[model samples]
Target chain A: METKGYLDMDLLRFTTAGSVDDGKSTLIGRLMYDTKSIFEDQLEAIERSSEKRGDETVNLALLTDGLKAEREQGITIDVAYRYFATPKRKFIIADTPGHIQYTRNMVTGASTANLAIILIDARNGIIEQTSRHTFIASMLGIKHIVVCVNKMDLVDFSEEVFSAIKKKYQEFSSTLNLADIQYIPISALKGDNVVDASKNMDWYTGKTLLQTLESVQIISDYNFEDARFPVQRVIRPQSAQYPDFRGFAGRVEGGVFRPGDSITVLPSGLTTKISKIYNADVELQEAYSPMSVCITLENNIDISRGDMLVKSDNLPNVEQEVELMVCWMNDKKMNPTGKYLLRHTTNEAKCVVKNIAYKMNINTLEKIVDNFEVEKNDIVKITLKSAKPLFFDSYKRNRGTGSVILVDEFSNETVGAGMIV
Target chain B: MSYNLNHLEQLEAEAIFIFREAVEQFENPVILFSGGKDSITLVHLAYKAFFPAKIPFPLLHIDTGHNFPETLIFRDELAKRYGVKLDVGYVQDSINRGTAVEEKGLNPSRNTLQSITLLEKLEEGKYDAAFGGGRRDEEKARAKERFFSHRDEFGQWDPKNQRPELWNLFNGKKAPGESFRVFPISNWTEMDVWQYIKKENIALPSIYFAHDRNIVNRGGVLLAESPYNTLLPGEKYEQMHIRYRTLGCMTITGAIFSDADNLDKVIEEVAAARSTERGNRADDKRSEAAMEDRKKQGYF
Candidate 1:
């Protein structure tokens, strides 16, 4: 509640993926309540709903089940975004359902997250759901992951059980590519090692979940090596006050750019020098990844939306045929023969699936090369050949420019998302 | 090597990016200004979004005829100051045309009718994108909304089929006769809005600050004494110094008893408040899925 102390605080956007019985909602409720973020009226509403439903105790899960269908079915059908703030940082939790059927929802939540919190029941160790969520997180290039071994109270806070789960998890996760993984033992229901350090687990000497969330090293998560600026709009204020001001309006996708930096316009290959960078009225000396600024170039090259600007020395791969791992989101089947609208950053083009490399067997991490039928929640490595060449980098190199989405041309629904290989 | 932005700055940048995206993506875009703090903050963000040039779009206000006089004054002055056209689609017009009927009850506020009028005007103007000031943290159903939410030809929002909004890539592509309701500040909370308002020193309507008004408490929800509301058998209006946490139709937007007369005090009070900002809104108390139902019918 103290604004003066930490008004200028960074934000951390993380996603929580857990099974039905993992107490994921309870864990979130505990965090919000302990942090004094659960408002009184909201708590009362939850209490009333719990009482009406004849729940033995206050049902914290009621707080997250937003839609009528979700509350009726007692499941999270969509991603629910919740916000909380500590004096140190502001947190945005993209709470997603963890059932196998809700993989699309989890993918939606994981896309924007800097970190992913995979909740594993202490008794169950590492299960299929765990690997699915973890694989999705790693596939999405989430740099940090926190594995909360929930329900430590049921295990009597035994360190051996925690060690076994950790061992099994580390063994299974060794096969996958994970950047950072921290295991914590906690009981979301009994409030152990969630907000404060666990008193029950004296042997475990790790920071509480809140501490980890607040102090996680996320500054290096951004791709600053390659400078990619996808021009979303061109600000041409042919006005009397400072006429002939043509600024390329865009959010810096990656790297740091300064005035006088020589940049190349994609597709056209025209070269220009940055004249100025403006964030609203104040002129910025330099702009980096994710900052929405208007940049002016010295050369008046014909540029519009869908055109990209990058450092001339460092260029991106401009290719018409691109291979990527596509995650099918909609119920409609992905048609390899039909053309779909492929959108990458500000660029939109028509593309058709050239070939399906293989399908990922989530449980075994095997490749199913024979099966090419892509259905809902299916992640397949496919090659798409667009009508126009796309300027992009690998998904690992730059998430902002490398990622793309496929939309159904007729239905206008975003059916698939992909990471450029 | 250090490139870090505070939460406010990050939220501002995100909002500005969204604004530019909507402007560039849609052929015709408009900002749905409700004269509330959220919409006012949205307008301020729009100004920062297209800095040297004026906002590329006009502002649309669905006037419910039951407005606070101060709100209309503030709304007109803001539009004039920004040098943008202010288009008002009156609910009374819808009523006159028999397209919308007024609710017959003790509290027959025109809050719900604004949606119909809004859809009519948007159809009339052929606007493809309507930017709203709705925040996810405000209501339960809104927590699941995407940045660029699509509406069908009937202006119906099918929550089950929302696009998967991943990363910073927002797909604003839609067919003809369909419009998108885009919320730039989807990640912002009530506290964040107030803090940004204070940090930016943005101007707000006088009703946001504490002032004496004739208010009637109906079922523990304080409703200002306006022509739209009729006094019950035993209910009577009493003078009270109050400030509003949100602005809506004066008949339904409940006022809280407070003395927070300035932005600093308001933010301080908000920080210490126990109840949620929307706890006082009587409209939401209609049903558990009130917001979801209204949103499905294209309520901004």
Candidate 2:
């Protein structure tokens, strides 16, 4: 369905990451300010804060980096989300940190992002931080990449420098598992090629940041062909108002769910029919991907949370062994023998790292063979065997069901993010 | 065409997703209901999220003895109506136990002290996760908060070290004694809430609509007359047509000068409002990052 006030178009969640002083915040602030999303009061506050900070001009970076320490240090410490809507599409910008220590935050921010905007300072071109952010974005399996060459103002908006940086980044990015990539040079500080076409850079003709964000084809982003629905909770009131109302409550992770369709609950291997689809009051004929609704079955079956409801034919792999690429997120060293709470779809079971295949050299895009030791922010390929069988396909096939997070038992922190290979 | 899912529907779906994520992740979860519009909306979404089945968890309210008599009544009625368990933590108990000290002044309020009672209650109940109707659009500090907000064992929120929330897949895993303050309606703005209330025909407290109340003008906000609040020197009480942008205690919760009594009117008024809804709340005006500062100390 088309969204209201969004040119009746779909919504997109994307992230921007780069090293410190790369203008990530400036780009986001430019987008919000140019699109008229930043309210008057918010602008006034920023102006006031800028004045208090003894700056003559407003610092656009102050918008996303909200923490006091971050503001003082002039770096993003944690991911800050900023929402803005254009006529074309609604956007949620995950402004992630560029520092090495906050790599886990970048991984977290990019996990759900459909697109990744990796910023490269035009003067410095592609550096170690750029490679790391790009690799992390690629490792997260983000389908689209928008390379923003920021601070073109400092480079006198030179096309040669832009093209050189673009070429260098393209060569480096070629090593990662990226589907689509686009590059644009802009001055986030001067508001060039952000919300409007930059007049200064006539040689480089490309859509503005907002235009790219809105027009980026995301209809194909979600896997609608493969049916996968993880029952989050069960709705059964047994009240006199709606007696005998039993429904499986959850969002459609992937695929379309229609009423009167044959479905099977995974692991249990029970067959049933989707008798009805419900979103609050109305009962619908069909409900598709990303829409949260409750589905009632014609045949009563034993299904609960951590169970999957999918099309009978397009079943997920129900095996104990899974080959995956995981980005370790904890400072505490990963223990291959340690028991991790593996959550895939809704099903969670104990899993152990069976083998460490290799770790990716982000800069080189080479797989370095290593022992099964993954430290913080290290992206490594591994084979995992869970205590219980998992029902899932490759992440490329279904981003919804194929992704997982490993929670450390001792700390209970989400220590690792994994994608099925 | 209404074919486009209304904002309410979108908000509802998002809340349901968050609710399910919390229930599935946390060991013991509770919805913090203050009988306010936001909390009311939260309970409504939580109910629909897991329909037919009883709400998976209980509803907790850290009550200050100084409350709008109506809020407590609404709290009990709602709990009975839904057949969900309700837990009430009292500020008076905390004050009596010397866990929290009561402030004495013309504008004294238990708003800040409620945190102590809340933390104690959460610890006593061993509740690992609490669903709060906290929207980022409500305040400056809240605007920067994560959907699955993490709080340390001391019930402190380190705004600097928040976990990055990516997609719909919420990672609710946290350290011991640390709880996740799940905000299902984090994206819904104040106008969106009123619109949803109007669309869903959700009943709110009587104080939400314009009513003639004996109020005193204090710092550009109308403070309702109550034993909880005293008339300070150079302040005189007078009847004023006022309505509440938010529902809290009679002391700290400020009344806005508005004639828009109905839900649709309220929506329109909110859509065109200048300052934030929390701007009138004096407790937040203490500092630029007062909310953040308080949130760091576990003040929900």
Using lDDT, give the best candidate's number.
1
**Superposed model 2: Cα runs more than 4 Å off:** A1-10, A39-41, A175-177, A202-205, A238-245, A370-372, B1-10, B69-77, B143-146, B150-153, B158-178, B210-214, B238-241
Worst 10 residues of 2 chain A by lDDT: A1-10
Predicted candidate 1 versus true structure: per-residue lDDT over A1-421, tens digit per residue? 6877556789999999996699998999889988999899899999999999899999988888899998888888889999999988999999999999888889889988999999999988888899999999989989999999999999899999999999998998987788799999998888899998888999999989999999998888988878999998888878899599889889998988999999999999999999999998999998987899999999889999999999999999999999999899988899977799999989999999999989998767889988889999999999999999999999988899989999898988899999999
Model 1 per-residue lDDT at A261: 98
Distance from true position, residue B298, model 1, in Å?
1.3
Candidate with the greatest DockQ versus the true structure: 1
lDDT of 2 by residue, A1-421 (tens): 1123522434577989886588788788888788766666567778888899898789776777676677677777777677766546567677788887777888888887889998989989988988888888877778999999999999999999999998888787776778899999898889899888999999977888788898887767777778888888777777788888888888887788888789999879999899999876778877777789999999889889888899887888889999998888777888876788888877788998888889876666778985556798788888999999888888878778888888877777777888999
B1-300 per-residue lDDT for model 2 (tens digits)? 122343356567778888888887889999998889999999888877776667879999988887888788888889998789999999999999999998876567888998899999999999998899988767756767877888988989987666545456677877666787888988876656776777677888888889899999888878888887878789999999989888878888889999988876776677566566776777876766777788898987
Error of 2 at B155 (Å): 3.1
True contacts kept of each: 0.78, 0.32
